[model samples]
Target: MSVLDQDLKTPIRLRSLTWLRAPWLFWGGLLILTWAVSHYAFDIYRALDARWIIRFPATWQPDFESRITAFMDWLLHDAQLFGILFRDVTRAISAVIEAPYDLVVDVLVTGLQQGIGQQAVQILPPLSWVAVIFTVTAVGHYTKSWSMAVLMGLCFTYLAVFGQWESAMLTLASVLIAVPIAAGGGLLLGVLAFRVRWVDRAMRPILDLMQTVPVFAYLVPILFMFGFGPVSALVATIIYAMPPMIRVTIVALRGVPEELAELGRMVGCTRRQQMWKVLVPSAKPMLMVGVNQVIMLTLNMVIIASMIGAGGLGYDVLTALRRLDIGGGVEAGLAIVVLAIALDRLSQAYAGRTVTQKAAQSQGGFAMRHRWSLSIIAVILVTGLIGAAASWLQTYPDALVINTGQIWENAIGYINVNYFDTLDAAKTFLLTWFLLPVRQFFVGIPWPWGLMAMTLIGLRVGGWKLSLLVFVLTGLIVLSGLWDKAMMTVYLCGASVVIASAIGIPLGLLAASNPVSNRIVGAFIDTLQTLPSFVYLIPVVMLFRVGDFSAMIAIVAYALAPAVRYAAHGIRSIDPQIIEAGIVSGCTRGQLMRRIKLPMILPELLLGLNQTIMLALSMLVITALVGTRDLGQEVYIALTRANTGQGIVAGLSVAFIAIIADRLLEAAAKRMRKQMGMA
Candidate 1:
């Protein structure tokens, strides 16, 4: 067809599309046209002649902050439920949570004491560092391989030698106590959800909210209800960590084969027995996966929970950051990384063991089977007997302990001094040329125009209900007087996500294309993911000082793994037959990737983007530590002031932004899958 014919057909197409005739097409077109004009052509405030549309006027903004704070105060100090004082109820709950936590802390961290004040004698020193290290190594050896044993031994030794043992132990104690509770609770809930349709339906959104909401958002409420202490931190960590375990539990249990359940029924097993014995055992491998997730998440929360008084390695890092002691922060951060790697590796090793391997190990005599346990007991006994004389056995001696803090500080100082101009130039160039302009553009857009654009996009992607949801959520941000801060968050998180994707996609492609590259990239990505998000701030802050640039670098480092992992998995998962057909059709490698592979993997890339966005938003909150003036900073400020309302509102605003992005991207991915007939 000539250009004239094509142009003539356009009028007929337009004529056929109207509200009464083709509402979806007509509305979609109208929305796109409206968005294009409002976003690109029409200056919103100038055209409307209303400054209130540009920035929500303070007088008009709702007093949600005060209202929320007041409600929290009443709930904490005066409210009653079912004729019971809420404060008393919280106290009772706190006691229950505190009991096990205290016991674990005493056993693993704080030494038992006899008497009081100066007369007090240390009846026991918190498991001798030597014993702890030996036990960790022994557990590693018993569960997996000598390599794992060596890894654990080295990790624990690093803590002891580097003067981080006590703090690391405190962190570990919390993790050890939290993991079983969170994982078990998650398992029970998941089982219930699997058994009951309504329970599953009800839990889906709650689980989504629990996982989507930033960890800092809940800290204020937890502190208010539970009182500020490690117990509050414990509660916060549980909430932050349990969602993944529950999600994994549901997925794992659902993935169990039906044949095993049928076999149990045929053998005269009751429903309870069938579920407990047949279904659960069959899902053990996957259940362990959930447990692993619980471990990792618990470690992540340890850092954030420190702000509320769960003092440990997290508190050390926080203190160091607060004082601007780069060396000290890096040392503490590295300790966290070491602890995380050890836990992650141990859990993974245990999870990877086969039923046959376990059964084989179980057949040994009692003494042989329990050799590692016996060795740990022997070491502890020996240390207790000799520790009074050889005090170093009880605690790592201060004189011998390594001080890498100075070394790290000196290294960072050297770099900053030697490369100041070059680093400053690059940072300035990026901020001035790209970041500032983008931020200004986003901040300058009228609130109404931005909201409408989102609503229209939501409608196009997921229809009217989603559009309404987006409108209300975004409108709430505006009314809460957080639109500008929210936009700043968008600017920061969006920039980080874009940079992460650019770096990750190529790496993912390389990993997907070659076995060696896959192994190398997979290992690197795994290590990156295991480190707590807080740790990322250390090196970046050291290099760039405190600013948005540092925060962006941290966010990118923390979020890059998902994008790479998802991209690699997506490409590697493509049907071999399809690739073969492309090859037979004379497509070059580049041509095949461009025309076939990339298109096929586009949905996966979108899903990866969704994950990247979620991670960046979560990291965005932590980035507040380095002085980013976004919603994260608002939450941080609220936390410091103990302003429950401000923190919750700011947190909800961040979560709303995340949810909006999540829903839009997910809807787009779903649509793509349908279009490709892959759904």
Candidate 2:
């Protein structure tokens, strides 16, 4: 038998240098040589002025942005082929999308922002805390699980009692607009991609770009096109949330049985009929999952959307962040989590509610059969009566609303007082010892040398096409004059990924050792991923006080979820037959893990690395707000100034970094698969 197939009770032992294959020697030598040349050759690595660097002309710097803007204007207007038609097209789309958005905003916003009610002298009243609570309870009961219903009620009640009702309502209203548009648009697009080979191929790159592009980056083009406020936020959220659904839809449609499709064909079904009756019905389970994803992603964008004026809970969090109001900020952040958890569980329940024909026939209770219609009617009646009878029911009274702000304030205050010196010393040490060397290593590398090394790595892994793509993107970042900022961003993300992986892998392995631990770890990961991104900065600011260290800690928290999850999944997914073989051979626990489990799960582990890196990079823009001088910082600066060119260039730089890392890891994963004979 091949050594790879053999199961031995003893652990596999290797002689020194025996495992160092030719590919490793070649790639390792190339990277080292490139690093030497980049760092030591003719002092070309300096940022202020450097050899082997191509700088954009100084002459074009002054009006470059205006020139680009002018060109675009001309292309959209002076270039007459698409002038009036383009305008009409955008106008028609705007009319269709904005009408419902306006109605939702009117019903929820403290005043009508824009709608038929805009000219109405009376301000549109917002939903009262009591009414909203009643509505939430009704929806919870509609889920047909009293436990889930109670959890939903408690979560939203925390929001109302903690004095976040108005903001939560505003956030919920915007999400209402966003989820439907995003979900509907995603479903349509998914169908198109599934049905058309050309569309499926074309959409892959676009989806990659959309998914990897930083959330902070999303605001600029959206702000430029739609202008700031809820409309712009709504549009951006839809774009951000659409990709996953489209992907899920394509997968689900393709998952339908070939035999079933053939049956439809034999029955003389038309294309539309076959899709509507056969394919879509079969795909409903996965489509519902995609819908659940859309809702979660829509909620996830709350804090980000608020950056451009989609107010509510997000606005409250942002406001608190700016003012450094720990208590208030914490409350607002928790409110967002509450909203996310409620939405998530409800959606999950709806998705999981599959009943067999026999099961359906045996089902009891009128509510189970007609939950939606009945729930809506009950909610409307209860809310209407309460809202009409009591002024307080129109809006929760401030006296009745409890302020838990003082609690968090005191907690943070005590920590700051007790641990300030210790934290400062620790932060200083990390800055000096840990973060700086890593930052310098990346930032001080000459552009071409690192680029060449990456190109070589890409060639070794994914072949010529991927290598060329990496070259083009790396070249663009250098030409954009953001190379230094890009390097710092890379450094920050790299350090975070390493640290997160170091912590997460062990946790994952431990969790995988038992089912109870796995469940506990899974719950934690879900909670971590669902929390508002802004909330991560809160405790970091309190402790580390906002720099690379604080940013690193926050990035670690945000990115660790995927890493740990991937590790646990990989460990858990090991073939049981392999385990049985190891056990029958009398392999020790350590031998079984080291020889069988870890080696077998290597491909999955690489995939987890890819996701962890992506998550870390996503935090770049947000981390910059806490004062890290990276590409994210530049994006933040551009956002504040509304500098379209700078913001876009920086955003693209971050995306390029993510894409490069993704390509490298994905290629490595494919290589692992090939080794396992699973390719």
Candidate 3:
């Protein structure tokens, strides 16, 4: 049948318009309309009033502060109980396992300490900062090319000149340690999960939850288990950073050619041997990508972990934020950005080089000769030693150190003189007029109303099963007495998602129209993604102050990437033939884009919206740093107080929200695709 004939037989209907006409819309709209009517039209705002009342136990006086005190007392009692249990368990486990491992750990620690101590004794003085920069440049050149080398040299130069050497080194040390540990754990987990169906089934939801839950929720549990130190920070970073590696590893392993698996079997290879020689080797690229992700996540978390006393560049950033020091935060944030870029590039180079070297080896050329590679390594070593020896005459200084006090004073002074008044004014308006009113509406709804609304929406979109799941998840929040906090979170997330879609979609459309713009915007998105969210929050706090506005801005910045990415993907994926036909049929550029291109990309755009929502939810915990009173805030408070139960509950609430949104959007996307005959 001809295309025009097919169209006549089967008419195209836009889902958005159909959705507007659906009965569910009327039901939802009527409920909202009625609520609006009662509240605004009739001046009956009783249902919109805050219902929560602060109450104190009999042991405390009946006052607001007394209630807070009583709650803290209860919290302390619970913490004490947890501490005792934890200590007893640890001691018991230590008695069982430490006898063997204590000696091993001691021996290793002592040996390493002695070796490092002896090496320190004989070490040459620190090289000139110039020489170090040169060395980095040379290393970069060796890895990639002169442009990268020069860029790396300049980056290191900035660090040294800015006197952030020690802080940067400390941050680097943590990441260097954390990445390997996370990647190793991820590799093992990924392999196990892929090899065992039961493991995969058990782990998939966990991975999803881990990825979805805001990072703040894990902080308290980690702090409790490891205690407050670099070790705790390290553990938290690893946990937060490891999931993507595990996911990618599983995906890559599964994607390996079936013929390769069969070939390994035909060679009589054991399962372990097949995994090691065939499966793993073939999946190296994906595994490397995972490694890259782990590295990025670790670097990103370094600053965040610092807030809980991780101590590093992150500490500096956090301090700067607390003091509302913009320049200092920017300086520290820049260092982090440079570090992220360097590490990212190095990993990419390593991965790309691995592929190239493997191809060279397969070709069996002079370039593949071990002797040449070994000689190059020998020369590098000799050169390093010579430089080390020559540096002995010089006095070594400590790594770069920033005068944070000066930066703080200057930045705070500048903001106080110029920006603080404006920020205060804006904060008053937002709080008094917008945020407070919106928050009141969300928290005012009886728990049942919110539950019914979300459940009914889920049911209509996904089905009865998803509806039940949604009720169970959200219902748990209401029952746990976290309904208000969850609602506040929903409000913030909802606002951020709306703003992100508004900005991201338009940018994506513009970028999709041209190649140069696409590359430019694509690079910006990449930078935004890799740049730690915390770093973005620093400048935001400086500009907007520590309020919902700042938090929303940061959330929108990070969350918008997926929207742009998916929107671009959707527009690009539209068939060229259809676009040409639109043009040939006398449609203007705007008409072609509006009618044909936009509709064609609706499914992909919907998918992007799904991703944008997910990303926004993920930022809930991180955005707490900007001083939100949402579930993220509760999670943060739980961490500081070691309230694991509250933290977990809040985290799960966020996760549930994501899942509900995810399922509904996915179903809608699927339906749209099917309706478009593109399923």
TM-score of 2: 0.89
Off by over 4 Å in 2: 1-21, 38-50, 53-68, 75-92, 108-127, 356-379
Where does model 3 exceed 4 Å of error?
1-143, 354-441
- Give the count of colliding residue pairs in each prediction: 0, 0, 4
CA RMSD per model (angstroms)? 4.0, 5.9, 7.7
The residue pairs in collision within model 2 are: none
Return the TM-score for each candidate structure: 0.93, 0.89, 0.78
Q: Sort the candidates on TM-score, descending order.
A: 1, 2, 3
The candidate, 1 or 2, that scores higher on lDDT is 1
Worst 10 residues of 2 by lDDT: 12-21
lDDT by residue (tens digit), candidate 3, 374-482: 5445544554466555542121244434455566557666876887878779778866886666665665555656777778777666667878988888776665667
| Global lDDT of each candidate | 0.87, 0.80, 0.74
Tens-place lDDT per residue, model 1, 1-679, is 9988876778764544324235477567765665454364336567778778767899988899999999988998889989998899888978888888877777787788788889988777778888889999999998898999999999999999999999999999899878988998999999999899999999987887788778898898888788789999988988888888888878887888888777999999998998898888888888888888888889889889999999999999888887878888888888988998998889889889977877877887998877778888999899878987998988899999999999988998899999999999999998999888777666666677788878877776787788899999899999999988998999899999999999999999999998999999999998888788888887788889899999999999999998998899999899999999999999999999999999999999999999999999999999998999999999989888888999999999998998899888998899899989999
Question: Can you rank all candidates by lDDT, best first?
Answer: 1, 2, 3
Clashes of 1: 0
Q: Tell me, by TM-score, which candidate is best.
A: 1
lDDT of 1: 0.87
How good is model 3 by TM-score?
0.78
Itemize residue pairs with steric clashes in candidate 3. Answer: 163-401, 165-400, 166-400, 303-314
